[model samples]
Target: MRLRIKREDLSAIERHSKQSFPLECCGLLVGRRTGTEFEVLEAVPAENVKRSPTLFEMDPQFVHAVLSRAESRGLTIVGFYHSHPGVGAYVSGKDAEFLKLWPGVAWLIISATRELIEERRAYVYEGDEIRELKIEVY
Candidate 1:
């Protein structure tokens, strides 16, 4: 599977990651699924209730609001994105635990250092395995 995101949208997510430096930032990936690819339309930032450097928990109320907004606009919550400040862009054990709950959802992991983003990678958790998904930013 593949995921495509606009350059501007990538920038937005990166900026959010930078702004939330030292703590993990998270948000929803709102867009449409096309063929074998997920085209991201927006990166909707959400408040990380955990607000911890190594963990992220989206606010329940904020998530509900985002879901309602997406449904109203005919957009699907295809996946989600989060930043791992000062860490590699790899799915961690905690991430896998959460990813498994959403079997077909795509996950975008952004690795950031200080105020700069180092890498961004996509993945999907299916059948108890976390597999990498090709990410095309254009």
Candidate 2:
């Protein structure tokens, strides 16, 4: 399946990736389900920073908070995003393993280096296997 991201959303992702350089930054992909398409509503960054790169444990309190906020507005958590510093935009073994646990959720990995920022890639997990999904920014 293809995931279409608006220009504004893409910009937000880029900004967050740059702002969280060196340390992986994570956030939620909020949107509504629409006829096989997920129209992105917003990209909500996590305020807590207990978990950094190599690990991401979304605080239960924060999750509840966001869910409560979203509930009132009729939105939902669609997927998640994170950055990979110095690594290419490809699924690593650890990522694959993680996907096994969070199946059906979209994983967006932004790769950045000291000199340049690589393209972002999205994937979905299906029974321990990660299937790359097409991403169209703008």
TM-score of candidate 2 to 2 decimals: 0.83
Could you give candidate 1's per-residue lDDT for residues 17-106 as a string of tens digits?
998999999999998887668889988998889989999998888888887888899988989999999999988999889889988889
lDDT of 2 by residue, 20-136 (tens): 776777788877756445566788887427446555556778878886787789987767787787677788787787778778777888886544568799888855667887887
| Alpha carbon deviation, residue 131, candidate 1 (Å) | 1.3
Worst ten-residue run, lDDT, model 1? 124-133
- Candidate 2 deviant stretches above 4 angstroms: 47-53
For model 2, where is the 10-residue window of minimal lDDT? Answer: 47-56
- List candidate 1 segments past 4 Å from native: none
Q: What is the TM-score of each candidate against the true structure?
A: 0.94, 0.83
Clashing pairs in 2: none
TM-score of 1: 0.94
lDDT of 1: 0.90
Error of 2 at 63 (Å): 2.1
Cα deviation of 36, candidate 1, in Å: 2.3
